[model samples]
Target: MKLKLISSIFILLGYNSFAQNAKTDLSDSLVKDKQVILAKYVPMANGEYLYKGYQIPIDSFINRVNDFRADFNAQIAKDKLSDLSILKEKDVMFYSYNVLAHYQIYYGMDSVGMENFGKVVQEKRGEPNFYKLIDSAQKKAFPKRLSNDERKRLDDIIRKSTDLNDAALFKTSAAYRTWLNDYLKGVQRKKYLADTALGYGGDNVAMLKVIAAEISDPFIKEYLLYTFTGTVIKSVKNAGAKESAYKDFMAGTTNETYKKGIMEIYINYKNMSSNAVSPDFNYTDINGKLVSLKSLRGKYVYIDVWATWCGPCKAEIPFLTKIENDYHDKNIHFVSLSVDRMADKAKWISYVNDNKLQGIQLMADKDFSSDFVKKYNINSIPRFILIDPTGKIVSGDAKRPSDPALRKQFDSLLK
Candidate 1:
């Protein structure tokens, strides 16, 4: 009876050991799978290095990454100490908090408790704080500096406001107006400096002429007139024209000189426009057939200037495809011109195929410097330009096809 009992106990122990080993094996397999998933999605350096060059396992590194991103997004959405506490253990929490604070301030949600969040944000400026991080990012992104005058203006508005709502309203109004005024002033200054340095000829002359017509500010108008007059005087000297003629032109009333300068600028701009037509472009289509813009002149054309890497451009493609399908019977032609470099041609083509772009897909081998981009003055994308049947520009600022109103307009035009 004792021997039988001992044998039964040994059997039970063996069973328990097997179960434990099985559980351990399952856990190890799950961990390996998770690591593979992380390696596939997250950017891994040397398959070993992790955040900021720290060497860690792919699974562990990705967990931290996901945790950091989630905490940062949460703080932005929920601007409170409790939400921030989620990232308390993170070393990079300060940077994430700063971003969250700026986002809150921008959306006017930072005033949940503080009456004037914008003022607080401004006053709280300095490195290691939230506002400074935002400011640093802005400086890196934009070419223009925040002028002292503009800062003073913002400060005055903040000082006047006793509550968040008042401060937000004041900022919304004053900030927009100040931006417009400063933009006009900056453009005028740039034109004058460019003219002085590069001479009032070539591209500078063309650009100055365009600016003269487009600008509406009185101070900018006066500055442009004076600069043009100075240029004309220099031109006369270079041409060896009589000094008397130069004096005669200079002696005229500022108003008359301004009018003449404006006219001259307009004429020059017109000439430049005439000479700036998009050059004949040749790019292989999906089927490896060469296509050119000059060949598609008879039909109304819609050009989509975009790059594969541009998220906005990618988002608009589905809408563009829908528009193309809806207007297939019409004489309108849709073209997607990609500014992705030639090296990325295969990838571009793959994306077009994968997304099934209905419109004609063409690559700009020279990328951003492509002649069509320069002709259209495309500073940002996804830009849409419509050319009428007669070849004149129908609308330089055509809306994205996702806009229902724009789609309606296109349908009417087709009819």
Candidate 2:
């Protein structure tokens, strides 16, 4: 009987050991998969920052975020934290709270999402925080900076604000402020990068290609490319460098929208060249008279493309009127083309008459996509175009009427 009992004890112990080993193996597999699902906010980089000369695994990071959201919503529906404890910060709890707070501030979602930001962000500013390594440029920008209890807090505040003037203070005081608010710093960063990459390049299309290729974030890449295109193409009098830039970009990308946008802008530059003839338009005036571009061929045309809803267009009006009055007797004609929609045709007529807008006032046959507007790809307005007496485009982007340069340009052209 004793021998039988001892043998049975050994068998039971063996079985228990096997079960324990299996449980350990199972746990190893479950941990990572569970963490990916339950975690919130993707835990904003542990203690590292990425800017220039670096890239992140954006696809994987986004996948983790999506997984977390799915699991979070499921848990919310069940009305249970499951294994969560308030005594310790769980990844799900931390993320949910922060996302809630983020929504409150940015999305006006005080009553929505998860607002646990109040708890996780309890670490006071200037504490041993996770936001990592300051760049060399940021360090130099704040040379005479005062020591702060929390420099990171100041950096965070300045980066989130919309005002550039408000940002000036942070530039001189905070560390790691360069990456804070990109809307303010983005243009400057790209210009510096472009200067380094292309050697103060007028080959904007080439510069754009370089910027697009270098940037990983889709939004920023698109924005930098688009913004620089305008600056580089504003002067259409010369197109040697631009032609090369355009060619390079065309060969590289398959993005249809980008291709279309760049192509239109390029065509606009060509259309507005001093060497190329201006795109003509014929429209009916308020007096029921048809005025055509060819009819005014002997005189220079300073065309103002505007609309009723455009605040910038309105601001230029007083200055434009002054130009009209000053140059009334010159061998020039100031033509105002209103791109106001058909719905606002009456409003356009009323505004023109009420303001007593000078020179030739004619309504555009169509809005921005009109044959005339598309010729110069006039995506934005208060646009001023200058044409020589022979109807050849002298400038696609002429000086604004308010500019003293406009008066100088007029005097030069009239002579």
Candidate 3:
């Protein structure tokens, strides 16, 4: 009887070990599969997308992404992967949901994407101590009073929150960028109307704070602060409000990584402040002649950095033409600098010639890598800059040509 009991004990131990190994193996496999799918859909470093080694239209690529999503969803359902035990695994659940969330948001299924995001948050919301646990940890020293199981649970929650925060932040940012691309291309679809309506509206800082207050995941709130503050710093024209927004976020979060990111955004904003010496560039004009900021130093330079593919940039052409005509004899040079990719240079040349685009039509040799673009932090198109005759920036983020404020500012400058 003793010999038989010893053999059964060893067998039970081996079975438990095998079960643990299987769980780990499956988690790793799921994570790898998720990453491969994400990598396949992510845009190239240059912002151009490729599908299966070929450059296809955005619409076609989105369709391919939907097909992949269908297959992934079917697999998950067939495997009954929504069981709480498996779903609690950070790598398996968060990554799988992230893949689905990104495509849904990017392809105009806003409600469905948000529903999935809420489900992830709702999972932890069931624990009555969830908010208290995170708040205590963030505000005070680690809780040594909790039992081992409680401590382990807290650690698990934090790890899962981190994964969910990162994935949501990245997916939302990409979706916003995708919306901007669609808007610039003039592709208005009924499906993306929800995204269209969502913008950094007036008083976004206050709006974000209210939304942050309701967020169940404290880490998600902190990460969101970082994202919102960066956008405000870069895009918000009101210096006072943007500065206040940055300070508010910096004060609220203890996350060192997020703090560093916000600081970098502030530094970049300050680098492009008014009256700073503007970054110079040399590029070939449509006439094949070279032009440089230094060469145009004796006159005020109204530089319009634009791309041929941008519909909004093209919309301002008529107004820009009027301004060029109005200020033709003034001590100012209207420079329309094209940031179209070098691969699209021929198309840019054709557009400029066909449209009779006025002013000094120049194309950057290195496109976005041109020194001026990097230095000025030019991420969006139709960016207008006003540099004084001495090459110091009058307004690094100048008013758009269509804005009455631009003509008003010009009138003052000319006088």
Query: How many clashing pairs per prediction, in order?
Result: 1, 4, 0
TM-score of each model, paired residue for residue: 0.39, 0.49, 0.54
Global CA lDDT of candidate 2, please?
0.53
Arrange candidates by lDDT, highest first: which order? 3, 2, 1
Q: Residue 247 lDDT in model 3?
A: 87
Q: List per-candidate RMSD values in Å.
A: 25.7, 23.1, 20.8
Candidates arranged by TM-score, highest first: 3, 2, 1
- In order, what lDDT does every prediction score? 0.48, 0.53, 0.57
Estimate, for each residue in 1-415, the C-alpha lDDT of model 2 and write its tens digit.
2232222222322211111000011111101233344334344343221121012133343344456656655555554444332211233333433333222122211211111221112222123441221122222322232224333443343344333332222223221122323333344455534333334333444446555544555544544454555445543234655676567556756666767767877877776664698878888776668899988999999999888776557757878888898889999999998887777889999999998888899888776657787677565677888888998888877888867898988888798
Write candidate 1's Cα lDDT for 229-292 as tens digits: 4344323222222233234434643666455643443343233345334345787777788898
Model 1 regions more than 4 Å off: 1-279
- Candidate 3 lDDT, 220-270, residue by residue in tens: 455556665666666666777678888888898898777876786687678
**Number of clashing residue pairs, candidate 1:** 1
RMSD of 3: 20.8
